[model samples]
Target: MRFAAALTAGAALIAAILSPETALAAEAHELPGAAMSLWWVLPFAGLLLCIATGPLLFHHAWEHHYGKIAAFWAALVIGPLAIAFGIPSATQAVLHALLTEYMSFIILLFALFTISGGIFVAGNIHGTPLVNAGLLLGGAVLASVIGTTGASMILIRPLIRANDNRRFNAHVVIFFIFLVSNIGGSLTPLGDPPLFVGFLRGVDFFWTTVHLLPETLFVAGVVLAVFLAIDIILHHREEGAPKIKDPTPDTKVRIRGLANIPLLAGVIAAILISAAWKPGVSFAFQGVSLELQNLVRDAAIMILAFTSLVVSPKEFRGANAFSWGPIAEVAKLFASIFICIVPVVAILRAGLDGALAPLVLLVSSPTGAPDNLAYFWLTGALSSFLDNAPTYLVFFELAGGDPQHLMTELASTLAAISAGAVFMGANTYVGNAPNFMVYAIARHRGIKMPSFFGYMAWSGAVLIPTFLLAGFLFFR
Candidate 1:
């Protein structure tokens, strides 16, 4: 009843604010970003803080009521926005986010989650350092093809099962988060949400593949090396101690659920088609416009998700231990995030003339050129805590919103932003969605995964130095 009431009230408020007459009027008048103050960003800050702290401090309450908490923040932002900028402008902003950005973003994630959930890796191997490194390397390569979430879901259990006999294997999962969940996703838009957002905003699909290669290899290689060294030492220690009986003895690895592989390919094709087949056709709702290709892509992805559900054996997903909870949580939280971020994106677009002029100045050199290193670090620092997708959008706009200009002239800056957002997401479990999912799955399988701070300590010691080296070599 409460959920229904909230939904109805939200719909009513949007209807009142987005009435056709008001929308038309609001189109003519715009929010003055220059006049806006940092206080305007408080709601966005509040929402992120809640996301960061809520699960840690109040797990039960946060799990049940996170959607409501998100809605509360969205209402706070929307009501003030409607009053201050007039309902039309606010309506247009909200519609633009919902109809365009949020819709595409969530749909792609849903398709990836569902399709990947259907494909289970069905084998066990010994957790020798060489075998573990091979698994990590394979997952890293697969991440760019199947997405970090997809790759993680398919490979995590087998990796866990492989290491089930090992005494010192928590580090293996930690390094998996660093490599498979974050760094490996650098090569393609499908690999990470930030890159996909870049793709949707007009960056070419292969741009990340070509541009981020050096950084990705460096980070992944270094992390893999570190894992190998640690695993060797741990293996030696285990040899000295009493041998624990192995569960799930080694066997030739085999791939299961091959049917969903084609569906996963279909999802990739749909995105590619959307990017290439722009009919220039669009549908308008109130003040929002949905382009033909984007609409087609989203519908295709939905169909693919449904097809996977129907055709893939139910036991495949069951063996994979798939559940809807993660995707549901993401959908609810990001709905509010997209809504609350409207003002923030606008302010950023406003650039030096906007309320965030100080931030704008920080990323620019005295000669007015962007500081690429600053772009990498700041984007990375924020991405380490906040979600990386929105953080990427923020910096992408700060560099200037012209895709052509960014791709042609300031390509390094764009690469830096993409790398920072994708790679540093390993710095914390909450830094990226897959990081936490992998952690949860490992914990559920009885791995003594580190505490939140304990995990950060791992990242701080290993990843920070590695990123610094890569940034100096590549971004500099």
Candidate 2:
């Protein structure tokens, strides 16, 4: 049923691409952000809070009826929007968020998940201190290449298996989320969604690579060093205690599903081609306008994902323990998130005239200059929970929304925003799609992973001080 829906959607999109320009009047159907009160954002806030507390507070109910909970929160926003803004206006807002924002976001993550899951690491190795660090480093590098989703999916099972013998291994997964899933993706747009959002908005592909290198190194280096130190102590402690039998101690480390490698490259090429091939052709669904290049890119990527399913052996995916549940969870939760974020984004678009004026004020100095330090912290803080991509977009516009200006003269501020959005996503489970996915995968493997707040405690202890020092060193 899901496959048929994907094909139908692809066929309709291709037909739309082939049809004559059907854009709906190229007019801005913007909500009145200035007039909307803070109360309008309650659904968004409430939904996020429920996401954080639901599992810990009511495990069985949340597990079974999370979708219903998500729908309830979405209705809270949608029902009110219809009452206050009229059905047409509210429908357009919700449709725009779903069709434009949520569609592409999920497609990217879905493609990465599908393709990478086929490329199984067939065996596990011992989790020595240096060995774990090496895996983290390798995954970090790969995150920028194939994206965080790809890197996490390809490496995580082996990582778990490697440490399955260890008594204390949850910290390993914690640092994996920090380094591989979030921090490592800073170097390229392919690495993280927020950077990709910037790219579509006209930021140069290499802009973040050049600007964020030093900051990326500083944070990655510090966290990695911390992981090494902790792993060493834990390794020594485990040696003194009775040894836990290694489950897969006999098999040697090897890579399977080699056929999927070129498909991964195809995914990258599709994204890059979309960026370069503008084509000046676009179609609209109601008020939302999507460019021709983007639609083609998505369809092509989905094709590649389908191709992986055809070519890769089912045994490889079985060995990796790949399942559709994690992506489904992400899809459902973020659908609610994107829907709830509509009014919040509208209010942000209102600038100083809106309810978040105090927040809008902080990113600037008293002299009306772009404060790099403030931009870093503010972008990072919001990104800790909110979708970093849109959070980055909001601040990108707040920083004047000019790609050339942001890339050149206001480079420091742009760097701060980019750094914050990419780096600080590690601060919470829901900060990026992959953060929660990685958490889900680890827990499903029987690792007693931390709760939402417990994960925050880890990030709060490790990431906060690192950001403070790095923020002062560079952005300040």
Candidate 3:
């Protein structure tokens, strides 16, 4: 059934690409945001809720039918949109999301996942507090280079293996999500999806690195300290107990799949080339504009992924336990998310005059200026549940869509939004894509992982205070 659905979706995408009806007309009529009501947001909200609860409440059913469930919610929006705004408008909207946003998003994830999956860390070391903290620190730095997904996949197994002899190690994986999967990604656009969306929207590729440095360092430093403290206590707790037999004992560390290292560098260079080399040429399809550089970037990334597959030894992938399942799940779920998000983004773009007027007001000060603090919390809070990429977009527009102005005059506001979206995503397993992947992998490896709510409790105790302090010191 899943394979059939994928084939159907692929066919639909191809048909949409080929149809001349997709060409943009001279006077394109956009769906007026002011005319749409808050009710239009229900489908998007419902889809997210289903994602949050489905695994916990109905694991068997959800595993088998999540794609169908996503489709059902997407239809609720598309069907109503066509009825109210006409089929052409509805088709344009869906095409815009799929072609423009979803394609770039999924391709980047695919490249990162594939290339990182080929690079396996061979051998393991004992998980002392110092060793664990060092691994977390190294992974955090690597996250900005390869991406949170890439860093997590490359280091997670070794970290797990190092601690396999420890009795109390769930906290180790929990902190891994906090640092490596979420906060550490704040430094580069390639590190996290939300920042990449910012990049595609005209923000400079290096803007995040310059603007978010202080916040990233402060938050990452504090979190690493917290992890060290907690890990120390836990390490002491298991001191006297007979250590479990180490499956992969300590050995000199060596890395396999060395060929993929160049491929990974190629991926980064491709992104830089795309950003820097623009010919000012674009192809428009039915209101969706495809730029030449972006097309080149996506093509280059796919080539890199394919190169990794060919050059890297199959045994390396097997050692890394690579499978297509995680990327496939991300592709299916995010396709629907991007589609369902169209109306919600429109409503948000409408601002104070639209149905989401209360949201606009909440993020503004009495002087009518944009509130950096509110932008931080609201963007972070929504990102904790909704996908952070769109959540960042909504607030990015709310603060004014001019990237030049954001980078210069309102740099603090942009930094706050970036920090919130990246940091607070660790609040739950579903907050970020890598968070859930790490959770599933840990559980499969026999860690007694926390339940959804249980994980939130951990974040609430550890992260919320840290964020509050950071907000007070920085965003305020």
Candidate 2 per-residue lDDT over residues 122-170, each given as its tens digit: 6668899999999999999999998988899888989998999999999
Tens-place lDDT per residue, model 1, 85-119, is 67777788888889887888788778878888887
Q: Score candidate 1 by lDDT.
A: 0.83
Q: What are the clashing pairs of model 2? A: none
Instruction: Report the error of model 3 at residue 341, Å.
Output: 2.1
TM-score list, all predictions: 0.85, 0.93, 0.88
> Which one is best on TM-score?
2
Of models 1 and 3, which has the larger TM-score?
3
Considering every candidate listed, which one attains the maximal lDDT?
2
Instruction: Give the 10-residue window scoring lowest on summed lDDT in candidate 3.
Output: 18-27
